[model samples]
Target: MTNPVLVEVVRSGFVESVHRGALVITAPDGSVRFFAGDVERPVYPRSSNKPLQAVGMLRAGLTIGDKELALGCGSHNGEPGHVEGALSMLARTGLTEDALACPPAFPLHEPSMLAVAAAGKRRAAMNCSGKHAAMLSTCAQLGWSTTDYVAANHPLQELIRATIADLTCEPIETVGVDGCGAPLFAFSLTGLARSFGRLVTAIGGPERRVADAVRAYPWQVAGTGREDTVLMRNVDGLLSKGGAEGVHSFALPDGTALALKIDDGAARARLPLLLATLRHLGIDPGDEAEALAHNVVLGGGKPVGELRVTAGLFG
Candidate 1:
């Protein structure tokens, strides 16, 4: 079935466009509270899988502290701190930036990207470098092969697969390569929400560790002015992560969880839909979130329209 329209673009009081997608929300008891569109279909969670991967790394003997662990579960903006953190992670493993399997890329943060433009793109500056470095560190500690840690059959990847299955309560429907070169596991949006619910509600073990790190070091997760960083900073006891191709997920300390994917991969639609879902759960993330949700569309450098969640979409 086709996905339902979840967001609308209003220009001069008229609907100019719409974004279609699927979303699922789970209650504190792990029951589906609300859902729209094809929540059962499997789709790539992309970097939304990072937190689960971090849990897998910890289970496989990764010993990084909270800050480093946060980075491991993040898709950072490649700011100075992010690059330095990835380097530090690699150094601790007796490896270097050269060991990262993710391709060289500029920072996602525009200022940082421009500042380092003269230095050229480096693998360490790629957003996924921290994740790759963490994988290498796990391999180093376990005496596994670092050269092909991103390989699907690699020990680290195998462990991560098991970890995801365990938390999501669903077998992975497909295996794919992530944007960062690591193995990607595809599962239903409902399963994704279920996993986040598990992460937030876990009292102990690697799941709690991953969730704690993401909450404690929100900056490490996404860098300055990013949505995940902003939301986590303002909302107490919240773990938020956004992935490539318009995937986003979050969970509150109460085990309230949400997962979403924009059908057309328009990143602009994500926050609006997210805010609508949060409202459905009686959450108010305040001014910054409001600003993000009501994203302005420009015409000749002036605001002419805005993106908004479709009226009653969540109801």
Candidate 2:
């Protein structure tokens, strides 16, 4: 394993917390150009792994438009559009929210959570609803069992697992349940970056379809003002997705890929670290990085300090 990178430091007038993590950048041909911290070890990619899973469903014969595809690959903000999209996916499959294996939960977006709670809606509005709905529809299309779709040993899950393996070009290490109840694999950070590279640079096929949907409907993939949304919308030919426990992944049109994880699970550190990583990659995010700095430290509701990448991150 390589040495860990000092990716970020939190400050409230002074250094408050430090985040140590690894980053792996791979070319389309699977050559590692930059390696930081333990890329050889397995990390739970969380929702950053969804695009590969979405393309997996595509190969499994799931049929839908760009909207559904975008939502299928998203960690949505649980906005009304997101909920409607999830419900619509279910509607097309002749199923209901009752079939979803994920426990009922509120929206990830605060305002939408308030509205959804007031309306007494739960499961269908959850952030993972679209992915759940996608899995259900894939089962419907493939004649697989929808009951216990989230189970680790389900045939549907096996296929999804195979897809991850196929894209990463590596065997699975271990399996665990995602926050949304779907079975997820422990994948190496280098493998994660390579898989994302494969997805974004894929030719005209299911992979391209997933990538195109993400680029075309960036909002559906996240939501208004969200980091992924902002980055995809404003940055040319950039694809970004963030996952729980401080996992972040992005890819370029040319198949440049980067995957990073914060050891402390600080979401605030992910973007700043990402911007610095991008700088190392020679891509300038320009004003978009500045615009997405909403995670600043607040003192009495006024901005006091900032979360930023530590110097010499690549050291």
Candidate 3:
């Protein structure tokens, strides 16, 4: 069945736009508790899959400290701290940033990027640099080639693929190139949610270790004032990650997970949908809706309208 229209862009007292999407909520046992939209179709989960991949690195004997582990699973905002953590991982392994395969980009934070541009530098501040650094470090530690480490068929990538399959409890259907030039696995949203659930609930494996690091260093997961960090900071026993193209996944300590993607890639639609989904699931996350209020509609540089769930859609 087709996914429902999950959000509408209301502007000037009208529904100016619409966003269709899929959502899957799964339990620790990989049971589907609730689903909406095309949850069974396979799609690249983008950076939301970082935690799963990071756990694979952990299982591969990749030893990293607290902040480094967080960065391994982060789409960092290029803050100085994040950059230091990423570069430090490379340095500890006697590697350099030049060894990375991901393309260089400015920091995601506006001020950081502005400062960087003012200094005539667009260095390896891309959000995925930490992940790349960790991947390269893994290869170096294992005596694998740093060259072509980003290749889909590389041994390093093979380990990651197997890890993702194990976490999601399903075989992958396709492989796509992620923005960071690493191979991305295409899997069902149900599988995505289940993967996150498993990560949160792992008994004593690499999954729990990685999840613990991310939860402890929430700032590295995104950045100061970022939604993922804010939500993770406020909500107890929750791990949240968002991806490019509107993909997002979050898990509770009990291993409940929700994964979703907005069809048109409307990132603005995600927070409200998250609020609605949380409320629908009977989880009262105090001040979370306000924490995400930055995405509210505006007119003439002032408060105008607000985005809300369609009446009774989550009821």
TM-score of each: 0.97, 0.94, 0.96
RMSD of each: 1.3, 1.7, 1.5
TM-score of 2: 0.94
Which candidate do you rate higher for TM-score, 1 or 3?
1
Candidate 2 wrongly placed segments (more than 4 Å) = 8-13, 286-288
Tens digit per residue, CA lDDT, model 2, 61-103: 8988888899988988889899899998989889988998877
What's the C-alpha lDDT at position 188 in model 3?
90
**Candidate 2 minimal-lDDT segment of 10 residues:** 4-13
- Candidate 2: the clashing residue pairs are none
Looking at model 1, residue 81 earns an lDDT score of: 98
- For model 3, the local distance difference test gives 0.85
The TM-score of candidate 3 is: 0.96
Writing each residue's lDDT as its tens digit, candidate 1 over 228-295 gives 99999898898899998889999989999999999999888988888777777778887887886658
> Model 3: per-residue lDDT, tens digit, 1-315?
644746877777888778888888897788998887899889889999999989888888887887888988999899888888888899988998888888888888988888788665443588998899999899889888998999999988999999999888889999999988999999999999999988888887899988888999999989977888887888888888999998999998999899999888878888788767777776766685456645568899986776766666754
Global local distance difference test of model 1: 0.90
How far residue 156's Cα lies from its native spot in candidate 1, in Å, is 0.7
